[model samples]
Target: MNVEAPWRGNNLARQIVVLSALSFMIIAAVIGAGAFGNTAVEDQQDGALSTNGSYLAPAGPAFSIWSVIYLGLIAYAIWQALPRQRTNRRQRALGWLIALTMTLNGLWLVTARFGTLFLTVVVIVLLLAALGWTFRVAVRTREPRGGVVDSILIDGVTGLHLGWVTLATVANTAAWLTTIAPASWEKAADAIGIGVLVVVGLIGLAIAWQSSWRLTPALALAWGLSWLAVERFGGEPRSTGIGVMAIIVAAFVLLPPAVIRILRLLRPSVD
Candidate 1:
């Protein structure tokens, strides 16, 4: 059965208005977060972890991906707010979810910066799960327009956010484990962190291979692998060898499908 086109019906204007308001709120929140303070909260067990310092550190620099993700989200919000596009149910739902996830992202940063490491991890995990679900839903929707632009935008943003958070969660968990657990537990934590990366990489590959949502995963995989290389060779030695191996395995597993996708894009249409 054909689904009714929500964008062509009632409430389109209202949806646009709501989306615009949400977009403004998100921008304000981001700005507020930046202006709050630059102080580093001290970890009782391990001196201080400065937000700027930690963020600039090798492992910490990875979080900067969020800046790009947030930019994409803002672009998406603006797209959804366009009066011409507001009636699409898929777009509307995606806009709301993006807004929700962005708020959570900001909160996680605050929590983590303030030394609430465990809570920060929890929020990041939830945000990752929520964004993954959002991407899945967007991928299954019938396009409002006769193109894949909306789906690609929504799913791409979701994939990037989810993929990075998946990695971040492992890093956060590792930090916590090292802090609270015995010295012997450090090895076990490293093992578990590498395992999580492998599992998450496979899950990402499955999503990219099986769905129409290919580009985002391709980009995410590239980003993930690049960081893996940096973390391995650029000074941070947290399971460097194993992490690099996992990145190579993931790249190999994803290469064929990515190549086919590229060829499909380059080939001319027969119609």
Candidate 2:
């Protein structure tokens, strides 16, 4: 009569173990960005991953968001291992993908630390794709009854991960290009930078639309873009035009989702 429950129970045990180990690996890797005898990504590649490395790079301070995300991942790992979460349908649906993301996070960092710039870009793009798929799955799955905690731990983390990686993918591509592209490309850097920001804004909007205007992703994306704006406006190799475009694009990507969220809160049936 309830064979599904037993199956889920058995499967969740294995998932919990696997997820916990992956989470540990990811936490160490995130921390290893600066400590445990490892150098920061910005400092690793002869500073090629620094704020000044690419036109699309976010300012140095923007990276502080990594701490919050790392904490979120750690929290999620613990939360999902709890007995109450063991047989949860949402967790069952999302557990493996979430684990995949954590694994990818570690892999991306390792590639950045020891592999070539091209490998770094490849791993990050794959990480972004995995996060995007995870986000889609999260949106499609209905949270269980009284699942507010699940919403925060799973959906929220996935959204933030996907959003941050989206912008990171762009910056990583730009950094890789800088290493390989012609020096003459610098002449058109301004134009190319603005074009890239425009595309980033569109991608943000698409994700928001797909996820019913989820706020966490927009917040993370805007956070990265705002820092890029700050860097372009005040940091080395400044471009007032790119700075202004970044601000505009940040607002552009952020406002619609915010407005839609507000509308839904007020009307409660807008969707």
- Which candidate should be chosen as best, given TM-score against the real structure? 2
Predict model 2's lDDT versus the native. Answer: 0.85
Q: How well does candidate 2 match the true structure in TM-score terms?
A: 0.93
Residue 81 lDDT in model 2? 78
Which residue window of length 10 is worst by lDDT in model 2?
A: 23-32
Which whole-number lDDT from 0 to 100 does residue 25 have in model 2?
Answer: 65
Local accuracy of candidate 1 as per-residue lDDT tens digits, 1-271? 5465653554464555446545555554454345455433333224323221121112445556767876777777667667666556666556556666766766665666553657766877887777777777677766553256665567777777776666565555556544566767555644665566667667766777666536665565556555655665564444565556656755754675577767777883511
Error of 2 at 150 (Å): 1.1
lDDT of 1 at 174: 55
* Steric clashes per prediction: 1, 0
List TM-scores for all candidates, in order: 0.74, 0.93
